[model samples]
Target: MSTLRMAAVSAPFGRDLEEDFARIGALIEQARGDGVGLLVLPEACLGGYLTDLDGAAELPPAFRVGGPEIARLAGLAGDMVVCAGFCETAGAKTYNSAVCVTGDGVLGVHRKVHQPLREDASYAAGDRFTAFDTPVGRIGMQICFDKAFPEAARAQALDGAKIVCSLSAWPTSATNRHPDPAQDRWTRRMDLFDRARALDNQLVWVASNQFGAFGAMRFAASAKVVDPGGEIVAWTEQREGLAVAEFDVDAVVDAARGGMDFLRDRRPDTYPATGGTPYVAA
Candidate 1:
C-alpha cells in the first residue's frame, strides 16, 4: 500500500488495566472503521501514569515485555500496526517503554531514554535510542521527556526512521497555569517541539498525548499527525478524540527532501563536542 492511513489518539487512561484495554480496543476498532492502518496511543496507556511524584516507595504497575498483557495487545492489533506505551519490567528493573505491534507479534520496543521530574524514582532510564522496521514503515518511538531532546529523534532519523511516534503525558507547567491549553506554555512547547522535530528530521511525525487530569497534573491533549513539511494535517486540540491522516509515506518524504535533504546535507564534522563546548559561528 503506497498510502497509509494513521490515527493519533488523545484520551485519558488510569490504573484500571481491564478498562484501559476496553478503551484501547474501542479506539482500535474506531480507527479500523475509519480505514486507519496505523494507530498511535498515548504514554502509559496500559498501566496509566504516575499520580504521586514525591510519594513513598510503592511502585506503579509494571509488566514483563513478554507477558500476557502484550500478547493480548498483539491479538488486538490484528492487521493494523499499533503503537502504545506501558510500564515495562525487564528482570528486576522497570522502564517506561513503548511497543509497536501487529497480528504477527511485537515488531519493536522503545525504552524511554529521558526521564523528567520524579520519573527516575519510578523507572530506570533507557541507555539507547534505536529505530526498527514496521509493517507500514521504518519507525521510532519516544516517550514524554524524550522528545524534548533533539538527539533522541535525530538518532532515529540517522537510523532511517521514516515515521516517529512520540507518545507523551505532557502537562502544563505546575508554576504557570493558563485556562486554555492552546495558550499554555507547556502545550506550546510540546506543539513547537513536535513540528520542529519533524521538520528538523524531515520525517512523518505522529504525536499522541494523554488527556484529562491525573492528580494535580492536567494533561494538554493536542494529539496530531504532522507531515514532513512540519504541517499538522489533523489534530485534536484539548479534546478526547482521534486525529487521523493519510500519507503516501515515500512520496511525502521524497517531496519534502527533494529541495533540501537535511540528513544527507548534514555537516557532522563541523559540530562541536557535547558538555561545555565553546560556541563557534558557522
Candidate 2:
C-alpha cells in the first residue's frame, strides 16, 4: 500500500442503527466508486450510542463474533478494508468494541483499552488492545474517550501501529472533554485531546465522531483526519458531515522522526506504572 485514503461517515445515533447501517452501505459503495480503499464509520454505530442502549442479551447472538451483524458489513468490503464501531460480548462481559474486516473475513476485534469516565454505567472496560497489518498501512483503534489517555495511544504506537482510527461520540460540553467525567462535551474541548495524541504519537489519526440529536443526547464532534506531524489534514464541521483524506505511510515516518520528533526525547525513566491503580481525569 503506497497511500491510505480514509473515509469517516457520520450519521444518526441511538435507535437509528438499521437506517445508519444502510446509509453506510451506500457510503461504502460510493467511496469504492471514488477509489476509496479504507472506510470507517462513527462510534457505536451498530447498537447506537449515548441514549438508552440495551444490554448485550438484546442483540442477536450471531452478531456476537461470527454473527449476521458482522457478516453484513463483512460482505461489503469489495477488495477494501472496513472498520466499524459496534458492540461485543466476550465471556460474561460485554464491551464497546470495534472490528476490522478484510474482503475475506473478520481480521481481528479491538476491545477498547480505555473507557470513558461515565462509561462504567454501560460497557465494561476492556483490558487489551490489538493492532493489525492492513494493505494500506498498520492500523489500530481506540474507541472514543480512549484518545484522551496518552498511554492508550502510546501502547498502540509501541506495538508498531503507523496509524490509529478512533470511532468516537464526543460531547459538546466544557471542562472534561471527549466524554470524560461523564459529561456531554464533544464540542467544548474537541480538538485539544485529539491534536495532542496525533502530535505526540506521530501517527496518522482518524477521529470520527457521531452527530445529530438522539433522545436527550446530542453529538456535535466533527470527523477529522490528523497527520502524524500533529497537523489536521482534514476536518469536518463541528455539526455533521463525512471527512476523507489520503495519507501516505511515509508521512507518518517523517513526522515521527523528523522535525516532529517529540516521542524520541521522552523521559520514560521518570514515570513508571508501579501499581495497577485506576487513572482519574480532572
Best by TM-score: 1
TM-score to native of every candidate shown: 0.95, 0.84
lDDT by residue (1-282, candidate 1, tens digit) is 389999999999988899999999999999999999999999999978887556443555898878899999999999999999999999889898999999888999999888777778988989887889988999999998888998788888888788999998888877769988889999999999999999998899999999999877799999999999999999998899999999999889878888878877776657645222231211
lDDT of each: 0.89, 0.70
Q: On residues 1-282, what C-alpha lDDT tens digit does candidate 2 reach at each position?
A: 367678776666565558766877887888787687877777777767755332322332214868877887888775888888887877787777888887688876877666555565567778865577877777888788788787877777766677788888765653344543223444545577777887777778888888776544567657888887777777776645667888676765664667536555565656656222232111
Question: Which stretches of model 1 miss by more than 4 angstroms?
Answer: 55-58, 272-282
Colliding residue pairs in candidate 1: none
True-vs-predicted CA distance for residue 260, candidate 1, Å = 0.9
- Residue-pair clashes per candidate, as listed? 0, 9
lDDT of 2 at 47: 64
